[model samples]
Target: MSRICKPYAAIRTFLLLLCGWVPLLTALGAAGQTRIYDIRYGNNAIGTLETKQETTGSTRRITLKSRVQMKLLSRMEVDIFAEYRHNVLHAAKATRLQGKSSADSKETSTEKSANGYTVIRKGERSILHHARITYCVSDLYFTEPREIRQVYSETLGVLLPLKLAADKRYELTMPDGKRSYYRYEKGKLKEVEISHALGKAFFTAREGA
Candidate 1:
């Protein structure tokens, strides 16, 4: 009877350990997954964007890479990296490369401090209060579908207010009163329509990719 009980108890402990680790493994797998999107403008394929997130314990990192060509003349590329702890962003960096040669590039970095944040762009420095920062080039709605009323723009260096619709659409009104709309389908972002001085441009995510 003692021998049988010993084996049973060992098996029970193993089972408990397996059960405890299953969810953690699944969460790690999900964090490592990547999503790619093809950007288009007026029936023409412009570029592609890839986004991924990594998590280790309570720390998370999100990265975005995008490359786009403009009318066969010059190409532009952008890379953004963001780090978060417990869902709050603590650091971020963005780099932009312009022209076909990629020689004309600019980099911007930000770090959070006890009081606020420090930003350095193209050798210029600035300080920000305790504000949440967001990148205008990246599609943040894809990762966080929650209704975000306002977001801080790292590029523009200001906080922008957004309007939300019942259909899971987000509208950002520019300082000049121009409006940009982000439409989602079934909680996933599908399209972004922008009305600006250049014209109305649409960015639709490729389906089944």
Candidate 2:
């Protein structure tokens, strides 16, 4: 996967929780907010990600869209939509397209059930029980900055330990030995730093954009 795809994968998994699990935590105010971010690899402007959230009655919806142009020939795009009702995820959908002509594409859809959550990807079905699942991608402390010791990663589909520093930053080490750092300000995610073998990639919020 490309560097841009890594964060999108994680975000896609978290959208599942946002659609289904965020309501269980706290109620967001009626006001809606949107943020635009620039994804950079070293000094190159590679892509942009736009995130928006809105609330109506007891339902909350979040949408994210990103497009990246890599090198001179390859391009990738991702779109995610999530909906929640009374703190329970109602439905969510994500689609990813790669290549100049979008020759390769994959999509995943999730729905909440009375028993648990159902996820469909590439024609495979899986049941995720609330009890069996200990954490979610939301626990990374981006939206929820409360103290958390571990997080469930939807990309890797596994539980990983998280280290929180005194400055309110959270760090996680990927399976491939790469480390990613997350920072938030005023309870909103501000930046993400991803370190890979090549170098560090920074995703920073573009204020007023």
Model 1: lDDT of residue 175:
50
Clash counts for the predictions, in order: 0, 3
Against the unseen true structure, what C-alpha lDDT does each candidate score? 0.56, 0.60
Considering only N, C-alpha and C atoms within 3 Å, which residue pairs clash in candidate 1?
Answer: none
Against the hidden reference, what TM-scores do the models get? 0.73, 0.75
Error of 2 at 170 (Å): 1.5
TM-score of 2: 0.75
Residue 19 local lDDT, model 1: 6
Relative to the true structure, candidate 1 reaches a TM of 0.73
Per-residue lDDT of 1-209 in model 1, one digit per residue for the tens?
Answer: 55433332222211111000012233355466466766655566767767666778866666777777645345667777767665556777777776756568777777887768888877899888865443332434344335456655544444556677676677765554656677877655677665543344565667652
Error of 2 at 187 (Å): 2.1
Could you give candidate 2's per-residue lDDT for residues 72-132 as a string of tens digits?
A: 4366777767676765556667777777455487777766776676777776888766533
